[model samples]
Structures are given as structure tokens and as C-alpha cells.
Target: MTRQAISSYKQELLDTARTLRQQIRAGEFTSTTSGLASGLMQGNIVILTADWAQDFLHFCQLNPVSCPLIAMSRPGEPLLPELGKDIDIRSDVPEYNLFVDGELTQTRTDIADLWNDQMVTFVLGCSFSFEEALQRAGLAIRNIDLGRNVSMYDSSLATTPSSRFHGNTVVTMRPFSPADAIRAIQVTTRLPKAHGAPVHIGRPDLIGIDDLATPQYGDSVPVHDDEIPVFWACGVTPQVAIRNAKPPICITHVPGKMLVTDKLNDELAIL
Candidate 1:
């Protein structure tokens, strides 16, 4: 594995997120937010018109594991004061994916031009929040060590529908030795908002994943021979849900490139 040296920072979670957001807003940080601004909450962004908000909200409620809704913005409001002091949804995220009629149309660094009074933004909890927890527990995350985006795949497991939204669950995978996998589950279980625990372990075939080497999203890292592949419910499940919903216009964070929020990771822990 090619390990990258991550710089050590003394700033607190809110300070870190604040500084990171500046870079993101300036179009300087366009890559995945994984392992960045550690201990702060990271969210998957999903924006849709008010007309489609209710069904999508219901879809999130139906699939809590994959779509743990955090803070949502009022229609036409771009600032999410509840999640951060002044989080501007239009430019807080490093990257955004615009989908039209179930097809991805373009990727944007900022969505200020697309913002409208009819649009509502949804912030879903992300697994990246627990990576810090795992590291605190002394487990090394392969994706962070390798400086690659976490591997994600479209699973065969179907999500419950809400009017127009319905699709398969998407899962993020991390390879670990059996012992570490067990510890990872325990470490992550405390962070319910961060996708909680492993949804599947050991057998990829059971989840209809034909090849671990070819993930549907993000870069694939090597899973060693002695390690088992561990899957966790991912925030990106909404993207699949959005594709099936087929709204005239939908916006989402490019998978892995998330919005760093000021909320602390420990604040999301149930225990």
C-alpha cells in the first residue's frame, strides 16, 4: 500500500471544518473529504425541488441505515445554520453531481447558479465520520493509508420505496483482518448517524458483487489475502434512489467528495 503522510493539525473540529470549507468554497479542494477535518461530521448532499422533497424525505425515513437524515434545509434556503454557523449549500461541498431524468448530466464545483427558491437541500450522515473513531480505536483504514477514496458498490439489497424513490442500497467496503473487522464493528456501532455497523462481512458474492476490484464508485484498494471485506451502509445510497426517482432535476455530492460540517462526530454517537 502506498501510504500518504497526512499533516497533523491542532485545530478543533469546528475550526478544521471552517478552514476546509474555505478551500472547498475557493475551488481548491476538489477531492474526497475522507480523513480530512477529522472528528467533525461529513455529510452527503442531496438537493431537489420542493415538489419532490416529501417523497425523498420518506425514502430516507424508510432506509435509515443507508440514508440517515441529519439536518435538512427549508425550501429556497441555502444556509444550514443548524449544521454549521454559515454553511452555504451552494458552495460548501467540494463537488456536486447534477442529474436530470435519472441520468447524471454534469459535475460542478459550485451550484450558486442552479440555486432557486423551490429547491431544498438534504444532509445525510456519512460513514466518513466514523473513520476517526476507528483510528482512535487503533485500527488503520486502508483508504486513508493509501490516500484513495473508499470503495463503494451497488448492492443487490433493495430499499423500501416512498412514492417515486426506490432502488438498491449502496455500500462502502473496507478490507480488514477478521480481528480488526470485529473491532471496527464495535468502534463504529457507537456512531449510529455514521451508518452504525457492518451490513455484510466476508462474502461479496452474497451481496451480488461480482468483483471487488471493480467498485461502482471510488477507487479500489487491495484487500489482502488474509483479510475479509467488510461492508457498511453508505450515504451514497441516495444517489441510486435519486436515479430511480427520476425527478426532472436532482443534485448530489459526487460520491466520496462530501460536505464537511461543524457538528462533532461524538455528538452523533448514541452511546
Candidate 2:
């Protein structure tokens, strides 16, 4: 595409992202953010009090693949201007999982009521940010085609510990023919912020996933006989860490849902 054409396309994507965020903030769109705002970056959110923020930040540093830190907000600061104009962390995500002492108490559309002076928001890079690239490379995304959330599993693979945070890594799975899988890997390797490449390919059993039909999170997607399941480190890994750490209060985006940002996905790509 020519520069002018590409610029127009990207502006459209930015407009879509901003509209989606507004809908989310207004409690109008609360579904999984799998296929919307194509060509833009999406993020996984984790909000914690100042007391637990340092440890969680360290945890992200230790496990860069699962928790690629993109943007972080200061305590009690709802705005993340670095991500986009008027990006309100508290109300931008479609759905928020409220955790109390390591247990999910409820799902909320907005967290403005819970936001306090000590709360800090952490935005992690999400694999969803790379889906548009895969499609651009002529690969079909099964989960998006199926119009369901991507299947996610809790792998026995462990993340390196940091202070009080420790837990198994969570991964997102997508099925592709061997040839397409290779191309998919090549396409995603450029976006380290989007978990880079598949952590595991082929057999699910090797990764401690007993059955793909029943994912620990998100919707189940079938793996065709000719295709293999490709797993990438997921941003949800922090939820497992939160469970282990048992912070007094924590908030995160729902499993399949995420926060859409105005940044173009290719802007973060490594050429």
C-alpha cells in the first residue's frame, strides 16, 4: 500500500479503537475483544495497590514473555496518556475481574468505584495485538473466524519468581496447518511485545493440557486433525501470580477481554 493509503487505513483503526474504548467505558460493549480494532494494539490490565505494585512489576520483569510490560500508571492515576489520548485505565477494559485475597469475587464492567489513591495500573502487551499481522501474512485466525474468544490454558510451565509472586504460566492456543504455523511464527517473531513466537507447538499433552476442548479460560476452539495447536505465552499469566500472591485486592481484564489502545501494532514491530 502507498504511504497515503496506509496512513488512512491506520487512522481508521485508531478511530475504531477510540470508539471501542468509549463504548467500554460507557458499559455498552463488554464482549471479548478478539477481533475488533484491527491493526491496533490491545493490552492486558492488572491493577494493584502501591504496596503490591513493585513486586508485580518485578514479576513482569522476570517473565517478559507472559507479562510484557507496555505502559504503567502512577498510583491513583486513571489516565495513561502514553498509550493514547484520554485513555482511562479504570473504565477502558470491557470487563474487569475483581479479585479479593486471591479469589475472584465478581466481574465488573467498570472499576472506577474501586479505584483508590494507592491503586496502580499495569498494562501488559497482549497477543491479540499480533492477530492482525498474522492475517496480513495470509493466515486465518481460527478463534476470530469462529467468532469466539481464543482458547487459553494453564500450562505446567512455570514463570521465574519475583518476591512474593510465583505461578505457572498461562498460554493462548491457536490451531494452524504446519506450513501456516511456521509462517505465523515468522510473522509474530517481530513483535516481542506481543509474546513474540509460540512457546510450544504440536502435542498439547506435552504442555500438561489434558484436553483442548476444555480450556481453563476463554472459549474452546477445535484443533483440526491436519493442524496442530500453537501456544503462546499469554498476558493472563499474571492472574495466576495474583492467585498465588493473594494480594488483598486486585483487578484484571477478563480472560478473553482486553484494553484496546490507539497505538498501531506495526509501530511496535521490529521490522
Candidate 3:
């Protein structure tokens, strides 16, 4: 493809996010929206029956680090206009992991078939939003540099339980020199919506991570002896929570794949 053609694909992905709420509302685009829209906000998706929404909401409130709530759809309402002018919770996300009795059975590009009047969609901010800031600052993201996804590990830290939802906080890891690690922390701190600061630096043992080479989710990036491994709270924590919640049924994005949005990453900054 020509550079213009590649740029066109990127533009289509970015432009679609602006009207993603509309496309999703109309059932046009539904696939993992990762790396498509650069500065716009992307999120982890979760959906559960209305009967379970309360408990899930409580779970998020109880464990904000692993479950920061960005926006949630009212029961049966597919539209999340507050998140975007025309977002449809039913089909906006590119892919959805379907869990039956706490076990993921299948994956779909859209969840319109599973839509119900009593279903609620929860959108949680993702760390990918801050990758832009880190890159702009001259720090190389190992996953991005390697054209792969960031590595995620299920930590030993148990999240505070709420009713039926409880599990460990899954974390994403990146390697950098102590100096670059500090810079990454500073850059990511500005985007709390995208996972904020490092929860642990240098010592994986402190967080119950016995092995850094094997991740529970996503591909592992190499860590040079001179570089320290930095860990951040990940949106994938919800998957673990979902498995533990055992909600008759639940849905979420596959690890690494994320829902791209029109909201800018800078828009999430407090400063």
C-alpha cells in the first residue's frame, strides 16, 4: 500500500471514532479498535445483565485501580451519548469476549445478538492512551516498538470484594531504565483515565510476580539487565474479576484489543 493508502486507513479509523457512536448505533464498525485512533481515548469493555449490574458497579467502586469506571450505559439502553455523541454500547466495540457461567465460550466482533433490555455496558479507560504521551517524550514502548501488544500479568494482590465480584488485580508491564521509568511514570500520571502511575517498579517480587518472562496476558517484552521492569494497573483486571464474579454471563474485550473513542487523551488530564 502507498503511504497515502496507509494514511487513509489510519484516518478512516480515527474519523470513524468521531462517529463511532453513530456507526455502533447503526451496526457498521465492530472490531478491536487498537492503534487506529492515535490521541483519542480507548477503553476496556464490560457488559452484564441488569440483575448483575449493581454488584459489578459496586465491584468497580471497591477496586478503582483495576476497575475505573469511565462511563456506563443504563439498563437496556445501548446509547452512551455522554461518552460520545452517538456511541452504542451494543456494537461500538470491535470485539467482545462472551463468558457463560464465568467461562469464556466465544468471541464476537459485535454483541448486538446478545443485546437485551436489561443489559448494561461498562467502559473502563485503558493504558494505551498514555503510550502516545510516552512516545512523544522520546521513550520507546517495547510492545509498540516490536509491533506487538504490551505484556500483562495476573498479580497476587487481591482486590477488595463487593457482593459477588472479587479477584486479583491484573497488571501490565514495561521495561525501562530507572531514569526512563521515572519519566514514564510522570508521563502516564497525567492520564489517569488511561491507568495513571506505576503500581510497582524494579522489584516484581513485591507484587507477587514471581516470573516476568511469562505473562498471564499479552506478549512479554524483553527486559535488559540494565533496565527495570515497571508495572501499571491494567484494565484486564476486570477479566479476572469477571471470572471470579461468576455472573451468569459477562462480556469484555480480549486482552490488548481495546475500544477506540473520539475523546482525546489530553482531555482526560487533570491539569
Candidate 4:
């Protein structure tokens, strides 16, 4: 536990997005948002100075699978009207990672003091938005059941480069039986905003992942002999790009922790 883990996930999981945001805004819930706000869309957050916003936007556009852009705020402005009526980019997420010169310098509950006229917040659609759909399709999400953050890895596959951002894609892994994975794919394919479907299936090594026990981000979950590993493009891909681009300062949601938005997942899902 890097920071203290929140209790009552089961009870709290049913909280509305606004309620959850209030808790997050108040600094009461600082753990992962993996299982909260069921049926609603969650977003991956990235805040950068005006100087780097355009290039980062280009990076996201180049790799839509990993960085599905949903909403963005004007420089120095903290409100994202598209996400929620009262969504404040400065304090709505549970935790934030502050990067200085491409290195993570600190994690904070809020970034109000750091917000400036040059800051721009970009919200990318998060894969957690599709978990309820997976459940509706009868697929089990392992990490949620195990009370842990999902496993994430850096693949050998490189992202399409932008003017100043280039790095390998970051992926989140979920293990499912052959039958369930097919259903999972079908269910998620309708929600392109949620990173869509699995990018790779089966052998982890083929994608350059050496082990399942250790991950680049989040907790590693168990993969049974009966199941295969399924990978999806993750929003954290931008964080990797940030490292390569070396911006003076950047603030992003800590991995697995996200901005739980007012919008419903069904609104973003294609029929």
C-alpha cells in the first residue's frame, strides 16, 4: 500500500459519480477508482502547461487506442463542463502525480496551488468505464474481485509518434477464459471511448512482457492455467510520453485512480 488503502469498497462502490467526486474532493477516498461509480464513465487525467499541451494532444490523437480523448479544459481553467456540472480538475480526482523534468516528484490529493494560467487539463476515456458492461456480458473482472489495482505493462510495441512525444504503449491486462474473453471483446468493442477491446491476447512474452508477477504499474493479479492474458491500451501511455518529452512540469492522475465523471457509460457506447 503506497498510501493508505480505503475501506468499504463494496459499500462505497455504489456511490453516484457526484457523491464519489465529493468524497474525492474532500480527500476522504484516495484509493483506486477501479470499482466505483458503476455504469458511469471514468476518465484518465493529464494536466500540462500550454507549451506542451498541443504536442501531447497530438500524441493522444496518434495513439487513440491508449489515449482516447474525451474532454479538455482551457489553459488555467479547472472546470470541465463536459465531465460534470461541478467537476474541478484541480481537486476532483483522488490523487495526482506531479512530474518535474520527466521524473515523478510527488503525489498529492489536489493541485489547486499548482494550477496556473498555462495549465491545461486533458481527460481521456478510462477502461474502468466498461467494467459494468463486461459484467453484463457475464465476464468477471479479476482485479476488482481481488481488491487490487489492475496489472499494467509496457509493451514492446511502439506508439505512433507525434512531434515531441514518442514511447511504447502502456497496456492493462485482464485474464479470462477463452470463452469469456470473446464475450468481453464483444461487449467492450461497442465503447471505443473506453479503450475499446483487447489489443493482444495470449502469450505475454510475444508483446515483450517478461513476467506476470511484476508490472510497470498497479498490482499484479493471478492468471490461472485455464485462462489467457488479454491486454488493452491504457491511458497511462501519456505518462510514458511525458518521460520522453521531458516537460518542465506535468500533473496526472495516479494510475488506477481516476476522475469519476457524471456521464454514463451507455452514453459513450455505440449500439
Candidate 5:
């Protein structure tokens, strides 16, 4: 519910990277990336060896909804200059989940020690970007308001497969009144990079989710009597691909925790 107790770095361009990297390097700021860096575009990270990047890249292209490619780094290069002036893929992110052979093995703050010449980092658009837009329009996101991670569920909807990468789609759920939900849809539709619009709304059953209270990942937010559940294609869907690919080594940001980019959400908005 609270950000790490570490002191935030001074507010400056260089300071931004310094602070962000420091927190990540220090094992602080390991929680979700939601509501942090208010105007920044947050990304879902997927790092794999170059040998596996081609297949994963193809998978993302085939399943754009769950894997909107934002920026990709060359093999072994940890710097993501496209996202920020001095971004370090190995340390800027708050937390990372390491997967070996499609199974989650470890979670850590930085991947510096694990970095290799064959590693390629993929930055995928995340739902957090549109969340700022929705809040700016005065819509209350239950997860943010409740100070809990957004609820994520693995759905029965299948994503287009690429070679070894294949799996069901994962979605993040938010509850909104019918009217607010309509506005949210309109507001979020502007940011295609941020999942665009709701894939499903008002019916959890349609997505094969049997219970609203039990999510496959992240925290569950309460749904009020009049509110309906609205679902957005989540960047977390890649985890399923990670499991399916069973790559020798893969690294990804933990659920909720994401890479904060310098790009503004408004810049990505489609008029």
C-alpha cells in the first residue's frame, strides 16, 4: 500500500534515472508501478536471449493487444535510450521475475549479474499509461483508490502463436459504474499502445473467469453493487507465453511493477 521508504532522488532529468536506478539497484521500490511517475509511460518488460527474441517478437506482432511493442534493445545491450536518455534495462525497473524453461524461478531488483551478450530487452506498452488518463478525467480506479494492485486474470481467449510462444490472454479488471465505464472506454481508446479499449465488460463469465475474488495475479479490488467489471488486455499476457516458450532463460518485470518511461501518456494518445 505504500511506496518503499527510500528517499526519492532529486527532481531532474539525470536525477530521474539516478533515483530510479538506485531504488531498483538497492532492492527498494519492488512493488507495483501503478500510480508512480504520474505522467510517464510504463512498460511491460520481457528480456530474453537473442536466440529467442525472434520468436517472441513474432508472437508480439501476432498478438498486439496483449503485447504492444514499444521499444526493443539490441542483443546484450541493456540501455534503452528510446525510452529514456540513460535508461538501463538491467536496473531501472523496480523488480524482475526470472523464468527458466517457462517456469518462474526468481524475483529480484536488478538483473545486472544475469545480463548476457545474447539478452534482448523488449518493452511492451502497459495498462498503467492509460490509468493516468482515466484518473485525469476524474474516473476512480478501484485498485488505485484502494491502494492495491490491479487484479489480473488468465482468460480462455487464445493469442496468436509464434513458433514456441503461445498461450491464453491475460486481462486486468477494474470496476466502474455503467456511465463511468463508458467514459473510461472512450478515454482509454485514445491510447492504443496502452491496450486501447476494454476487451470485455460486465461479464466475467464470458472470459471463463469463475470468480471475481480470485485473480490469477495481482490484488483484487472490491466491486460495488452497481458497478460492473471492465476488462483490458494486459501486458501480463506475456507471462503465459514465457511459460509456453520454456526458454532456457527469460526475465520479466513482476506483475504491477513495470518500467517507467520518459514518454508522456498524452504523446501516445491518438486523436
Candidate 6:
């Protein structure tokens, strides 16, 4: 894309994010943010108590590819001014998953009632950001075309541990022709914060994923015969870690329902 075209795309993204966030806050839009607000950064939300924050922070550091920590709020603070001037951790996300004792207990649209001074919010870079980059590069994302959530799998690849946080890496897969996959690698490589590039390509067995049609999380889209299945380390990896940690209370954005941020995707990209 040319410099002028890039600037125009970014402005459109900013406008979309601003409008979408208002709807999200009003409880009017409560679905997947995937393929919406293109060119803006979408984040995976993780909220925990101060007691578990340190260990969780360590978990992010140890598994940077899957859990790249982009912004965090101080203990007891629900506001993350770094991500957006209006971002409120307790209400910005479209949907939230509440976990207790390593098991998912409930899913909520807003966590205002659960917000406490003891709580801390962690925003991790999401693959959705790079999906936009792929689309801009003229690559077709099957999930987007199918109008469903991206396919996610629990891989055999274990992440480095940090205290009680340890689990297999979770990945998001996108099918592409061999030629497009190469272009995808080149495009995504520029965005490290977005889990930059595929970790595994062509073979699902190597990653211990038995079936592409049946994903461990999210809806599955068809992979054409000529296309290769490409996988990238996913932000949901921390949810697995949180489950292993078994903290007293944990909160995260529902998989596919991310927190749309004001930051531009290009801001997280490298030359």
C-alpha cells in the first residue's frame, strides 16, 4: 500500500473503532469484533486480583508470542488510559469469561459488579490486528469470508512456565494458498505484537490438532483442498495459563470477542 493510502485506511479504522466502542459500551453490540474496525488494534483482555497479577505478568513475559502484554492497568484500577482515553476495563469488552478455580463459571457482557480495587487488567496483543494486515495484503481470511469466528486449537506445544501458569500453546488457524501464505508471512512478520507469522504451516498433526473442522474454540471455516492451513500463536494461550494457575478469580474477554482499542495496528508494526 502507498503512504497516502495507508493514512486513509488508518483514519477509516479510527472512525470505525470510535463508533463501535460507543455501541459496545451501550450494550448494543455484543458479538465478535473480528473483521470489524480494520486497521485498529484489538486486544485480548485478562483481569485478575493483585495477588495473581505478578505471576500472570511473568506468564506473559515467558510466552511473548502467545501472550504479548501490550498494556496493563494498576491494581484496583479499571481504567487503561494507555490503550484509549475512554477505555474502561470493566465494560469495554463485548463479552467476558469469568473463571474460578481454573474452570469457566460464567460469561458476562459487563463486569461492573465484579470490579474491585484488588483487580488488575492486562491487555494482550491479538491476532485480529494481523488479520487486518493480511486482508490489506489481498489475502482472504476464510473465517471472515464465512462470517464466523476464526478456528482455534489447543496445540501440543507447551508454553514456558511462570509459577503456576503453564499450559499448551493455543493457536488460531487461517487457510491460504501456498503463494498467499508466503505473502502472509511477509506481511505479518512486520507486526510482532500481533503474534507475527505462522508457527506451524501445512501439517496439523505436527501441532497435535486432530481435526481442522472441529476446533477446540471458535467456529470452524472450510479449508480448500489447494490451500495450506497456517497457524499463529493465539492470545487465548493466557486463558489456558490462567486455568492452570487456578487463581481465586480470573476474567478474560470471551474468545473472538475482543476489546477494540484506539491504537492503530500500524503503531505495533515494524518496518
Q: Quantify all predictions' global Cα lDDT against the true fold.
A: 0.92, 0.93, 0.82, 0.90, 0.88, 0.91
TM-score for each predicted model, relative to the true structure: 0.95, 0.98, 0.88, 0.94, 0.93, 0.96
Report the candidate with higher lDDT, 2 versus 5: 2
Off by over 4 Å in 6: 1-12
RMSD of 1: 4.8
Q: Model 5 residue 207 lDDT?
A: 86
Q: Candidate order by lDDT, highest to lowest?
A: 2, 1, 6, 4, 5, 3
**Candidate 2 vs candidate 3, TM-score winner:** 2
Model 3 bad stretches (over 4 Å): 1-34
lDDT of 2 at 122: 95
lDDT of 4 at 50: 93
Clashes within 3 Å, all models in order = 0, 0, 4, 0, 0, 1
Q: Candidate 2: TM-score?
A: 0.98
lDDT of 3 at 34: 44
Question: Candidate 3, residues 62-148: lDDT per residue as tens digits?
Answer: 877777788998888887767665566666666678999899999876787888888898999898888888888999888887777
lDDT for each residue of candidate 1 in 191-243, tens digit (9 for 90 to 100): 88899999999999999899999999999999999999999999999899888
**Per-residue lDDT over 221-247 for candidate 5, one digit per residue giving the tens place of the 0 to 100 score:** 889999999999999999998998899
TM-score of predicted structure 1 = 0.95
Q: Which stretches of candidate 4 lie over 4 Å from their true place?
A: 1-15
lDDT of 5 at 236: 93
Clashing pairs in 2: none
- Top candidate on TM-score is 2
Best-to-worst TM-score order: 2, 6, 1, 4, 5, 3
Q: In model 5, where do residues sit more than 4 Å from their true spots?
A: 1-18
Q: After superposition, how far is residue 188 of candidate 4 from its true place, in Å?
A: 1.1
Q: Which stretches of candidate 1 lie over 4 Å from their true place?
A: 1-11
